[model samples]
Target: EEEKEGLDKEEEAAKSGAADGSGEDGGGGKQEVLDKAKGLNWKTGNPKELKATAAALIEFCKEHNLDIPDDAKQARMNVGRLVLSMKGSSALEIVEEAIKKYGIVAAKAAKAEQREAAAEAMCGHPGNAQLLLAFQELAQLYFKEGNRNAG
Candidate 1:
């Protein structure tokens, strides 16, 4: 298909861009790193691959003069812990265990006050703040419903 050919062309360009060191701000390398992350075998719970991907992401952020977001840092820590404690479990089992141990969804739901505070901090007027909070909650709901780009 034309779309596949277009993608192949873009991939070729990205590869050549890296070889020639012509990508702006190492964009080609960043794309390659992201591709590696996307290629991860998550179903098998390969801790080594997870750790390597995490480390690569951290290093990439550093090298690009970008701050590691809190969520990314937390993910790296989670990967580290998982790597250390894994005993040949599938990623699904690992995730189920994590959900039970950390109550991840419950914790998110319990942070309503924090969201309210943050919304208020970003918007001084109380009515606007409440509106912002409502929008935020709506966006979160959409995201949970599998519309990742809802926000």
Candidate 2:
């Protein structure tokens, strides 16, 4: 009988402790979770919002006939990281600038890759020295013209 009473009292104490939050502050855990979520929202700013902004920016690029990258979401995420790293700048401005600039960067990288592939293809040919020399001469001529224009 004593053992049964002790067990019942222990159970009641445990229930009461849990009901009273076990001496912990009420809603502390919930508030921490909310703060974490808010920090993440501040940093990444919701992928859906990013999508909306990116869609309009992409449409503008298309209207202007600009080439957009295949991995645009990744680009936006990367630019989001860059924007977060910046100090004293508006996030909207940074994101807008990224939308404007990252596509052109992707286009330039594509052009560079094409040029590298063409160079490799040319180098694979058996008698490409003459072609290379011609390209070198053309590059020198281009530099000369550029320098003249700059002056």
Candidate 3:
């Protein structure tokens, strides 16, 4: 009975996490943003107001110094691009603000690939070199995945 209770507790926690959209990628905030975006009545609201909301969210993230993960950044960028493409300059400005605030972190994460490659070049031990090469490959894969997802 104790084991069953523990399992039930674990399942409940998993369900809550999923409901909150805090999956393995740690994109709870991004999910919330997407939800809010979906909930907005774009046709009824003034376009400027929508843009202002996006801008405010960007500022909020900056003021909080939120450390967005790579996947979330990519998701946000993709959403921004979509909004910009659909809504013109105002939406683009919001996206630009988001990029300005979060772009550096995302770029640094991508550059980890280069750093791993450099480490691989510097290492002398054959086993270490092999491991570093594997790491470098993994980093490159992540960078490419992020780039693709961002677009």
Candidate 4:
């Protein structure tokens, strides 16, 4: 009876771990992006800037064969909306072009959230951070240009 109870306990533990789905096994490439985004330094920039940054970051990830988590995609879309709201149609065009080149699977809204999270995780990697930061700066430049024209 004791042996049977032990086997049951082991089975229960395995089931519990599987239910959590945290991907503790290091094979969770998607979850990695989500975790990275959650841990990002929000102080680095404004939402508009972050959106642009995330777009660029997505491009980088694609180039490197990295997978962006599903949750990250939602975040990217939210940030991208803020950027578009601030910069207007031109920015939208740029995002559209990128999506076309990459594929519909890499839509703006989804890509933004994923990149934002991925970038947060990649902060420790200078190359990744630089690329993302550059994207943000470019977006800021476009924003300023738009404002100037409006003025």
Candidate 5:
């Protein structure tokens, strides 16, 4: 009975925190950054707002201990590109991408299984580097083709 009561109390606390956005899992830490991004007066041609938005995103990543690119200049450039290429991307989405890119979050069980399967498949390859290079080239080609099709 005591254990059940304790579990109930903890569950309630978590629920309240999530409902009010007062817990880390609820993005309480990111609310200020989100507000700042949303508060910006964005225009397609407005460099000031674009720069501010990128700054806010970078700051958010830093605060969350996500890896920024090793090349600072390239990171900024990529962030600029992301800001300009926004079709329906949200600030939260941008941060989430960074988190995934940096492997900041642990993979779910299914993802882990998939990764393990891929690794096993690749283990028998005699020329891993060459295989990877070919794969990268093919991926780039596919991306180019996709862009052409989209536009």
Candidate 6:
């Protein structure tokens, strides 16, 4: 009887807090963005600004405490490509072209080496080509995974 009463009280507290907007799950908004990122079409969305897209992905992962999936990484690289397209910089041009032709994962990542392993493990699926491209972009940029503060 006492345990049931305690459980009821906790449930009420949770419900009330939710009603009052105090039980912020933090994943609601981020989950929506994650869904979007997960479903982003690579072919279309021309003139895609990879930097902004990457930023959005990063924000979503931070809020939801998730890892950088391959597509998001591709978005980042695409951003760099867009920048190169606009400025015609030789340095970025090399990367932009290099990635479109052949995406290299952990090509020379001495800092984010752990991310390479994680991405490789995730590439077990045949559909992870885009993810592979993204991971390579991350390695090229030395992007680090956000803090994994998952509860």
- Measure candidate 3: CA RMSD: 12.9
Each model's TM-score?
A: 0.28, 0.26, 0.28, 0.23, 0.39, 0.19
Candidate 1 displacement at residue 125 in angstroms: 25
CA lDDT, candidate 2, residue 35: 33
Q: What tens-digit string does per-residue lDDT give for candidate 5 at 1-151?
A: 4433543454454344432333455343335544444543434357777787777766665665444665778778876777677624666566544443442322222333443344434545634645643554576577668864433
Could you give candidate 6's per-residue lDDT for residues 1-151 as a string of tens digits?
4433543454454344321112244222322333444444322133454454435434543443332335856646654454445443332233233332322222213213433444445566746745774744565355345533320
Measured over all alpha carbons after superposition, the RMSD of each candidate to the real structure, in angstroms, is: 15.4, 28.8, 12.9, 22.2, 13.6, 19.9
lDDT of candidate 2 over 70-123, digit per residue (tens): 577864565445554443344344433443344333334443444344444556
Candidate 4: tens digits of C-alpha lDDT, residues 31-139: 4444444433322146566565657645544543343344666646744553444453333343332322333222333434444555555466645755764665576
Q: Please provide, for model 1 over 41-109, each residue's C-alpha lDDT reduced to its tens digit, 9 standing for 90 to 100.
A: 443246566676446434544443232334866757864565446545544344333332333222233
**lDDT (CA) per prediction:** 0.47, 0.43, 0.45, 0.44, 0.51, 0.39
The candidate that wins on TM-score is: 5
- Model 3, residue pairs in steric clash: none
Q: Output the lDDT of residue 91, model 3.
A: 33
| Candidate rank order under lDDT | 5, 1, 3, 4, 2, 6
In model 1, what are the clashing residue pairs, if there are any? none
lDDT of 1 at 31: 40
Off by over 4 Å in 6: 1-48, 68-151
